[model samples]
Target: MNSDWLAGGRAELAAERILDAVRTVFIDHGVSGVGMTEVAEAAGCSRATLYRYFENRQALYVAFAGRETRALIERIWRDREVSVDRSPAQQLLDQLTAVLAEVRKTPHLAVWFEPANAGIVAQLANSPGVVDALAANFVARFRPGLSAPAAGRVGRWVVRAVVSLLTLPGSNEDEERAMLRTFVLPFVLDEHTVID
Candidate 1:
């Protein structure tokens, strides 16, 4: 891997391109259903080349999760779907709803929530790294003055809510919104957010 990288190939760019290919494969075969060979083939790279970038299935999963989560979060905020005029609680609700909608619309992401893949999705979503990043970026913007650990706790709860909903959505958006209002908002925003 290093030798090829040293020979002038951009490893990061190669890895990202492979991941892009991996997404369409995941769409065809749910995240858990896709094998490494399938990934390598879809990436149009030899298995050795794929493994050079991603050591194994788990590494690929983590890399994919990190990349996609960051992209999704960036898109949600960039869209400005959550209005400034709304209360923080409403804004939070809008953000959560936006995440669900976004994921559902994207085939690769939607497949990740398939019943067979839900366990893997849950594990990755609840991982400390994901939670911490979400806390530092997402939670911090809403729950200012909270410590990193505190924000992380909030982030974990949010992840749980998201995974649960993704795995088993409610009958309708109203019900989902209500569930978040009843279950999520209290714990996440239990402490009043200090807006500046």
Candidate 2:
């Protein structure tokens, strides 16, 4: 029951509350339109308190993106219904496709994919520690022989491709899947990896 521990717990809760407010605001106002003042108002906290939790709008957005990315990764792994016998390439395709579907299904996360907000989302997506970790982890799990740097590169590429598709979707899901198989798999998977 230390005072410092209590303060720390309160701070963490406040930060989470602020993020929840951000989710609401982002969905209502769009990621590009929301600012610190708006977030503070939505969170029922002063601008100073909001700043103490998140230094700037970009910082808050990055934090939100990081949180969503982790959730998306967990959901993908959890909901995976593919058989163990599937090839690594096939599994990766399913995983990436699920990622796109999940983002589209989540309103706050989907807003970032809108043309106006996509640049910001892309910036965060390409950042080293954000979605890259999730992507690299997925790749490493499916293709365990890949080196860390190589897996990381594939991870970044997967993020970039997902962002691209989100920004400018293909004719349909069928076309998108075909594109991933033809363009993405060849580069992401090992040369020896078969895609049956």
Candidate 3:
């Protein structure tokens, strides 16, 4: 039993080490440019060993993105500057803008925004786990009265908006802010509200 427990611990450690290697490779080469062989080489493991942890590049991408997304959410929550007293619309805008700025500044996370990898990132963002995290953060922190389903819907819209901005950025930050305020704020705050 002790030996089995040790083996499981070792396996978990190995998987985490592999993910660390994946982060380095993602930073060095954009997420789309990386492959199983590159990950294996970076991890100092045989291809077969790497495969034991991640079945394919897509699986690896999903895992990495999930990890990064969780970290980003935690960072957003940890930010002392994010005042809770702000209006729902203002809070959502602040959070969305903060997420965009953080992802752009973090090289490992930023690689996913490259045009080649945007589709993959968008697909991953739609996964239930990611959507739930976004919903929980938005509901519990920003809008306490929002229903779970409502939060999920709003969260997905916010994510789509963020992904769009990341993929095809506006002319400048001012323009981007204007676009979010004009297009996203109303819909996110009130589902029935339509923007003209």
Each candidate structure's count of clashing pairs:
0, 0, 0
TM, every model: 0.88, 0.88, 0.83
Model 1's number of clashes is 0
lDDT of 1 by residue, 1-196 (tens): 2335324656558899788988999988888888889988787777888888889998898888888988998989989665668998998888889899999998888888888997898778766675467546687777677887777777776788888998999999999999999998877776764322
Encode model 3's per-residue lDDT on 36-154: one tens digit a residue. 98988888777888888788877777777777777887788679356658777777677778888898899998888888987788888776675566555565455556767666676
lDDT of 2 by residue, 1-196 (tens): 1224225557768888888889999999999899998998888888888888889877888888888789888988999966879987888789888888888888988898888986787778766687777788877786777878878888788778888998898898899999999988787776575322
Give candidate 1 misplaced runs (Cα > 4 Å).
1-8, 81-84, 192-196
Clashing pairs in 2: none
- Could you tell me how far off, in angstroms, the CA of residue 194 lies in candidate 3 after the best superposition? 11
Q: Which stretches of candidate 2 lie over 4 Å from their true place?
A: 1-9, 191-196
User: Which candidate model has the greater TM-score, 2 or 3?
Assistant: 2
- Candidate 3's TM-score reads 0.83
